[model samples]
Target: MLRPDDRGVLYGEGVFETVWIRDGVARLRDAHLARMARSAALLEITLPDPAPLVDEAEARWRADGEGALRLVCTAGPAGGEPVLYATVTPVPEAVIAQRADGVRVVTAEAGVSRERPGWSLTTAKTLSYAANLAARRSAGDRDMLWVSTEGYALESPTAGLVWLSDGVLHGVAGDGVLPSVTVAHLLSEAGGVHGEATVADLDRSDGIWLVSALRGLAEVIELDGRGRARSPWTGRLSRIVSRRPG
Candidate 1:
């Protein structure tokens, strides 16, 4: 439990990672911890050794079976150690269904100034998610694809974009977007580009997929009410990421 003055509660000072677990194994645990450590350093929050939490997450998954395991570390009350916790919850039906059925999305202005380059919190998964939540709420039932004022596709609130253009998978340039671990892994396996594209340009692609730890690879079947053709690569890409390392 958090004290009344916890930094995470008062100022949203913290970083978090959502991990996908299957058969008691937390997928990409090392990559998740690396990103969390990078985020903690950027925020100047003292991150404790993650070994205990990692063990706890694995134990919890063994007892509870497959689900989403969220690891949150935050700056707590002044002069106290950072607060860390692992919460495992059932994966939402929509998220599971989207893995196979795909998702429909609408575009929105990301609000943040993507034109001005900087190493700010945009790359970190911080608790100050008010803007991300607002974007999702604005979308209602559909997912929101954030685009810059210059018409460049940014990313969704929680996932990264990967579209197939002329047989090449492409994601938004790493400059302003969060460097997605999932997308990076997918690109390493299947090959892709870190570049910019407008919504119109993305729509014309042979296939569009949203990559994330939990979502795996969900193709964008419809964008802004326009239907896209089903892709043959979705299943192959899914299997590539879903492989459980021995």
Candidate 2:
């Protein structure tokens, strides 16, 4: 729980990870732990060992099985020790439906500053999610595609973009974007195309997907009012991610 004066509550001095649990096992456990450690290090926060957390999650999974699991670490109140906790939540029915049927998305010029300003925690999964949440709200029921000021596709609020073109699987370079673990794993299996993407480039792609931990892989079926037929690879990719590492 957060105190009124906790740094995470007051200043968002925290990081969190969302993982998928299936058959009493947490998928991508190592990758999520590594990313949390990196984010904590970047924020100069001392993170506790994650082994116990993983063990506890596994125990919970054994009791209840599949669900969404969240791990949160906070810098705590001034001069206080850091706080850590884990929670499980039901995976929303809508998310499951979208994963099966794909999502209809709309692009919005988000004016994201890729320069990684001094105050920018872009590379870290920090607790300050106001901007990300707001952008999604602005989409008015449709998922929002974040674009940089220069017309490059950055990412969605909670997922990374991976598109296929000319038999090449293209992923937006991690430089100005969050280094998405899901996308990285997929690229390792399917090979990768390293580059930036504009709206037009995305339009010309053979397939496009929004990848995340919980959602796994969701194909983009429509964008900005234009409809795109579901790609033949969507089901295959979904199957691959459903068998996610445990």
Q: lDDT (0-100) at residue 188 of candidate 2?
A: 71
Query: What CA root-mean-square deviation does each model show from the true structure?
Result: 1.6, 1.6
1-246: candidate 2 lDDT, tens digit per residue: 789999999999999888888777788888989999988988989999876988887886654546788999999999998899988877777787778888888998877655667656788888989998998888887888888888889899999999988888888897668788888877777777667889899898889999998888999999888898778878777776778563
Give each model a TM-score: 0.94, 0.95
Q: What's model 1's lDDT at 175?
A: 59
- Error at 11, model 1, angstroms: 1.0
Model 1 regions more than 4 Å off: 116-119
Q: On residues 61-172, what C-alpha lDDT tens digit does candidate 1 reach at each position?
A: 6644567988899898888889988788877877888899998899988776676555577888899999889888889988989988888888999899988888898877
Displacement of residue 152 (Cα, Å) in model 2 is 0.5
- What are the per-model numbers of colliding residue pairs? 0, 0
